[model samples]
Target: MAISPFRIYDIASTFLQHSLHLTSTLHFYARSKNEYSHGIIYVRRLSMNLNDYLLNKHLLLVDDEQELLDMVVSILNEYGFYNITTAKSIKDAIEATQKLRPELAILDVMLPDGNGFELMKQIKQYSDCPILFLTACGEDEDKFKGFGLGADDYIVKPFLPKELTFRIMAILRRSYKSENPIVKLKNSQIDFSSAQVIKNNEHIQLTAKEYDLLSALYRNAGCIVTIDALCEATWGANPFGYENSLMAHIRRIREKIELNPSQPVSLITVKGLGYKLIVE
Candidate 1:
C-alpha cells in the first residue's frame, strides 16, 4: 500500500525518537567456564533500499533566464527525472518551496526580483534542502560568499551540459547514502555493495554515478537531503559544476528498479524539499 506523505513523516519522527531504545536484545553473555575471555557484540540493522529514490526527488530551478531554465529541464527530463518545478524570481522560489519542498534547489545568482544569494538564505529558512548557485558571477568573493552561506555547489555560466549533470549526480549520491547497502523498494531490490539491482527476474548493473546517488539518498532514508549536501558528499568541497549529471543518473536508476519507470511509486517527490525513501 502507498504510504501517505503525512504518515511517512509521522512514522519517521517516531522512529528517530526511539531509535536508541531499540536495543532490547541483550548484547553480552557471561562465560560459563570462569576463564577470563574476551567477547564481541554485534548489532544488525534493518534492510533499507535506495532504488527509485533519486528519480522521485522534486528539484527546484530558480532563474530569470527562460532559456537556461528550459535547457536544464530538458536535460533533467532526458535523464528520467520529471518532477522538477521552476521559478524565475526569489518570491516565486520561496512560494514554490513552501507549497512543495524541493530536495535540491538550483538558483541563478541574478534574478529579476532578487539575487540568488539572498534568496538562498530565505529558502534555507523554508527547507534545509541543498542549494546550487548557477550564475555568471564567478569572482573569488562570490564563490567565497556562496560557500559561506552553506551553498553546496557553485557553477559559473556557459556551463557544459555533461559537466552539469555529472556534478548533480555526484552531489545526490553523497547526500543520500544511508550506510546500509541493501534496499527493498516497490518490487525491486538494490544492493549497493554488489552494484546491481534485481527486478522482474533480471539482474542489472549500476553505473558508478548511479550507485553513488543511491547511497546518498539511502543514507538519509525517510528524510529529505539537499542537493548541495549531496554534491559536497559526491564531488568533495569543489562540487560546483555537476548539477545536470545527477538527473541523468537518476533516470537510469529508475529504469533499473521501477516496474513502471514512467510513474514511480517507490521513489516519491516531496515538492521543494527533497526525496524520501518510503520504508514500511
Candidate 2:
C-alpha cells in the first residue's frame, strides 16, 4: 500500500513534537512515495537542550528494511535529529541525494537488489559529505571494504541506537569543525561558501582536494605562500607525503579558474615552493 505523503508527514511531525519533545517548527513534505522530508524545526545557540538534536543539520537514512528505517529515524529524532529523509531503495536513495543533498548519509550495506557500496560511489561523484555505513555485514573484510570506499565510519548492526546516534554526532562534529570557509573571489562572483565554486553565474564543480586548495589560495591571496604552507593548510601538519596530491589539486583548480591552466595567469607556481592566487 502506498502511503500518502501528507499522512506520512503528519505522523512524522506529531511523533517528533509529542514523543521526542522537539518543538522544532517542522515542515514535512512528501517528496515521493518512498521519500519524505522533515525540515529543520528550530535553531537556538545558547540554551543547549534536546533541541540540539536537529538544528541546522540534514541527514539521509537509506535502508531496505521498513522497521529498521523507522527505528533509525525514530532514534535520530530522539536525539534532536528532526531534519531527516528516508529512502527504501537505491532509486529512491539517488533521488533523495538530488533533492535533499544531506550533510551526512547513513547507508545499509545490502539493499534488495542494489548494494550500498554502489550508492556510495554515486554519492561521492557529486558530494563529499561524510558517509557512515550502518550494515549487518560486519565481517573484517566487509568493514575494510566500506572504509576503502571512503566511508568515514562503519557500524555493525544490532547495536544500540544511542551508540549509533553518538557515532553520527561525532562524525558530524568532526566534519563541521574542520571545514575551511570558502573565499569569495573577484567580481562579487564565485561563491565558495560551499565546496562547489560558482563563477560567471555558473557552478564549476571541484573535487574535495581542489576545493580545499583553492580556498587556501583565495584566503592567503597576494602573499607568496609556500608549498609547505599550502600542504599544511589543506591536510594539516606533516603533508610532505601528499605533495603529489597537492599538485594535482592545484592543477585542477587552475583549469577551472585560469584562462589556460597550461599557461596559468591567476594561480602561479613558485618553482621550489608553492602557489599563489592573483585574483583579477
Candidate 3:
C-alpha cells in the first residue's frame, strides 16, 4: 500500500512477458521477488493520492489472452487496484458484470465471443461506470467508434504499462467527478481525497490489503460481497487458498475502523453469502 507508483510503473513498463502460467490458466506476473502476489493497492478519491482513488471500484477486464490479462492484472495490482474481476469472452464479461457490478471496465478490442464494442453495449445496460478500450487496434476508425460509443479512454497495445496505469488512474479520477469526496460510515468516515479514516477524533491508517478489502465491501456498500469476490479483490485470479487470509484481514480491519471489533456494526458478516460494509 505504501509502494510508490513510479516503482510499479517502472516495473510494468519494463516487463518482458505480459502474461504468466498458473494452474493451466494464464495470469499476469511481474519479474519480481513475489511473482504471484496481487501487485497494486489504492482506494478511491478525485484528488490527493490519485492511486488511492484507484481503490476498490470493482474493475472488469475483458480479453481473450489469458497472458495479457494476467499481465494487466499484475500491473493494476501494483497500481493499488485489487478488486478486479476478469473475463475472457463477451459472454463471460456480461455474466461477471451482472454479478460484480463493476464501477469501471477495461476491455480488449477483440474477444473470443465478440468485440469490445459489443461488450460495451451489453455492460452499459447494467452500469454507467466509465469504460476504457485497452486494445491492439489503433486505427482511427476503431478509435472513433470507441469514442462514439462513449469510451472514457483508449490505449493501443504493445504500449508502456506505465501509460496504461496513468490512463486508468486518470479515468478513475474523472469517473468519480467528486463534488464531495467524502462518505460517512456508521462508526467512521472515509475521506477518499486523502485515503484517510476518522473516528473518535483519531486518524486511522489501513494496511494495503485491508484497505483493498474495505474498498471492495464499500463499493457494494449495503450489499453483500461474496467471499470469493472479496478474495479476487485482493488476490486476483488465484483466490482459492486465501479464505483464511481474508478472515485474518477482516479481523485486523475491524480493529482499526470499528468501535468494537467483537461486535462490528459497520463491517458486518452476511453469514452464508459474504460480508457487507454498511455505511451510515
Index of the highest-lDDT prediction: 3
Considering lDDT, where higher is better, how would the candidates rank from best to worst?
A: 3, 2, 1
User: Per-residue CA lDDT of candidate 2, range 1-280, in tens?
Assistant: 4444322122225564565554432323233333353322221111233323233367888998888887787677566565578887888878888876888999998998689999999888768889999999999998999999889999998989879988988888778875544444442233555567665667777776675676556544533456665676577646578888888788777667665678877777877656667664
- Top candidate on TM-score is 3
lDDT of each: 0.65, 0.67, 0.71
Ranking by TM-score: 3, 2, 1
Candidate 3 segments whose C-alpha is farther than 4 A from its true place: 1-50, 179-262, 265-280
- Better TM-score candidate (1, 3): 3
Clashing pairs in 2: 25-41, 53-80, 54-80, 227-274
Count of backbone clashes, every candidate in sequence: 40, 4, 15
- For 41-122, candidate 1 gives per-residue lDDT tens digits of 1111121234345555668889888778778776664443445678888888898889878888988987898788899989
lDDT score, candidate 2: 0.67
Please give the lDDT score for candidate 3.
0.71
After TM-score superposition, what is the CA distance of residue 60 in candidate 2 from its true location, in Å? 1.0
Q: What would the per-residue lDDT of candidate 3 be over residues 77-175, giving only the tens digit for each residue? A: 655565677778899888888876888899999887889999999999988989999999999999999999999998998979889878887888887
Error of 3 at 101 (Å): 1.4
